[model samples]
Target: MKTITVKRLTEAFQLEVLAGADRMDRVISRPRTHRPGLEFVGYFDFFPMERVQVLGRKEINYLLTLTVEERLLHIGNVVKYHPPCFIVTSGQQEIPYLTLFCDQEGIPLLRTSETTTEFIAKLDGYLLKALAPELSIHGVCVNVSGIGILLRGKSGIGKSETAHTLIRRGHRFVADDIVVLKKLGPSTLLGTHNVTAREFLALRSVGLINVVRQYGRRAFQDETRIVLDIELSPWQENALNNELEVIPQFTEYLGVQIPHIEIQLQPGRDVAGLIEAAANNWYLKQHGYSAVDEFMKRVEDGMQQ
Candidate 1:
């Protein structure tokens, strides 16, 4: 039930208010828009009331063909449905009757200079992002070798410290501390830095430092699609010795399963190097090469020989 107010849309799209200024507070709950071409001729069975109604060149021309009384009757019928708002595209001219009816009914009527197709395309994209499902996770996201790696584990496990080391090695930082994950589609999850902590990393000894300021623009990324999840945990002897003997692991986020791995942490261990190697290994797996699978195949060949 997320909604974007008409006032917000006006500001975002720079829409011109032709009428119904008092209705700027109207809320738009649906990202999809509706074109009332068929409904213009007295068909209301399939008319969508929750979507923003669009009036383009063809719709306006058709309204002109009707006599004043017929036009008013038709427009009044549509207004009775109480749509969220009406947007006029192709901004060539204004239909006085339509504007008047919308004003009287207190329905926001907005005009845009862009063509029908362009306006709809942009509006759909904007709405999709604005209404996409989002969730926050306590982890660190980084872009290593063009692959997004999300590091997750208990606090004090050196997630930020590992990320800092990776940053020094020329990898791009996506987010630290709080990672905001948004479902871009059925299968895609996009991760970005939380607004309050963008480009800032917290360290026990150094306190808070801005990574962007320290490393410049090349060290930071606005967002990245998460492809790998690595969990850092306290070292348990021989816990991961059989990792290569088992099937690869995966973690589910927003209904999509992503490749997952767990790395044990201990003092003096090269955590950053291990993560970097994992990223490279993930890249190779994506391109049809897996070291574990290859090694197992080699063992089978040797046994046969």
Candidate 2:
């Protein structure tokens, strides 16, 4: 997680602190203050966690109107219980006890003349960097029904051409060449295309072109989840000999397991149709139906007979 410091904010905004210069060195995040004086409570809520709190000058005055006991409680909650990075925006207002307590606790107190809006705008990008979701790239992601399908394969295989055919078949596009994968949460993999490279899919003979304009909006998708992984390769005599064979299951992506499938593509095969089959099969599997498994069971019964 990246942190933006007071010095950096000052430099970015070209603003000076009216008070609490000693606190200017504090590193913090963009903390939202619900009300004046309660800003202290918000800071206290995160207690001891390394988070920065920013408050407008008017919010400070609102706190000053509170009873001394209320103010003390806020201070006590933060100073004694929860300590965090504190910042006051639109400076020159003073809270004597707050400053004293901050000094005693060695907590950083910062002030800036910049309005809360301006201050937040400056910290917005940094905050985004800190909050960005993690990503992993193990499977190939294809855009199908606005879903990101990851097609895994060895080099020299026609993954890009298959994707191109899918695009021509009225499916949207995401990443054609390389898909960027990010982990959104537990057991979930997010696949997205590089923004600059998203609109174009590279073929062996033809170069890149904007899929959106060439094939229309239906030819491209914004992004999709990596629900299925189709592994493409030349058909080999020793590779997956049985049409009814059940390959080993893969349930993880970048160490976090997930639902996966491997589809082998060979010469003179309908790759786009196979991809559509994969997508539909995934949907059926999600709903507790496996057409291949059912056929296998029937075949086993017939063999017994």
Candidate 3:
């Protein structure tokens, strides 16, 4: 199971440790956070122990309504679950015995300056991205007219060269040589440069070049949502003709299906321009304008006449 430590969350969220610093190594397996208001009221039937427990304003106010003895009893019951950590939002100081109970039980008590709603939203977003399923593919990713295009092919097939050409044509580079992909949601795949390969590209005779330094900041992008996949293959006599007959090809990655196109690589072909056109065509298709569909409709109308 994937897990994040309380210490990692603390660093990521810039949380201050109010108590239980020794238990910062506590593991949180769930990407979701929980507010145990019901558990605070002695309802523990379905409390999620593996999640980070958030003590928001509502829960803190409820605790204030209880007598000291009643407060300790409810706090004890909740802490006994050994939650990954307790985060008090809105920079609220600890309730009467909160720090004591957390310290005694070795449960990390974290405090963040952000309000309850803001902290929860930020934490949820962070955890979702931290735990998202990720994979790396050997390819070049670029943004052509705001559409993310992933170009894949065998080694030395000019992926970087094509990317360089596109960069010169005012396109933005996401990654070269290796593209790291993460599934943000059911239908979205986010692509970024591999950490070790960021801002760098390898090309024949040119060696290693820093894209940001060579092409300026506008030519490099931190990440983009991948919308299309294009696989470059060495030119075959009949492949180009066959590709024209195919419509709406798709490839599956990380449980998501993305539009896929295959192009033949040959000497003297404007591959970069082709990639740019592919991106424009994808944008048009998204808006219900398909060249193939329009042509087919025209042919049907002619036949009917």
Arranged by TM-score with the best first, the candidates are 3, 1, 2
How much does candidate 1 score in TM-score? 0.85
Residue 115 lDDT, candidate 3, scale 0-100: 90
Better of 1 and 2 by TM-score: 1
- Model 1, residue 11: displacement in angstroms? 1.8
Per-residue lDDT of candidate 3, residues 1-305 (tens digit): 56788999999878999899998998877778999999988887898898899989999999999989999999999999889899999888756499999989999999988999888998987887777788999999999989998999999988999999999999999898889998889999999987888899899997999999988999999899999999999998865754444667899889999999888998999999888888898788779987887889999999999
Cα deviation of 126, candidate 3, in Å:
1.3
Give the TM-score of each candidate: 0.85, 0.62, 0.91
Roughly what TM-score does model 2 have, to 2 decimal places?
Answer: 0.62
Q: Which ten residues in a row have the lowest lDDT in candidate 1?
A: 238-247
Candidate 3 C-alpha error for residue 241, in Å: 3.2
**Sequence-dependent TM-score of model 3:** 0.91
Cα lDDT tens digits for candidate 1, 216-273? 9999998999999999999998776665654678998878788888889988999989
Scanning candidate 2 in windows of ten residues, the lowest lDDT window is 30-39
Task: List candidate 1 stretches off by more than 4 Å.
Answer: 243-246, 283-288, 296-305
Clashing pairs in 1: none
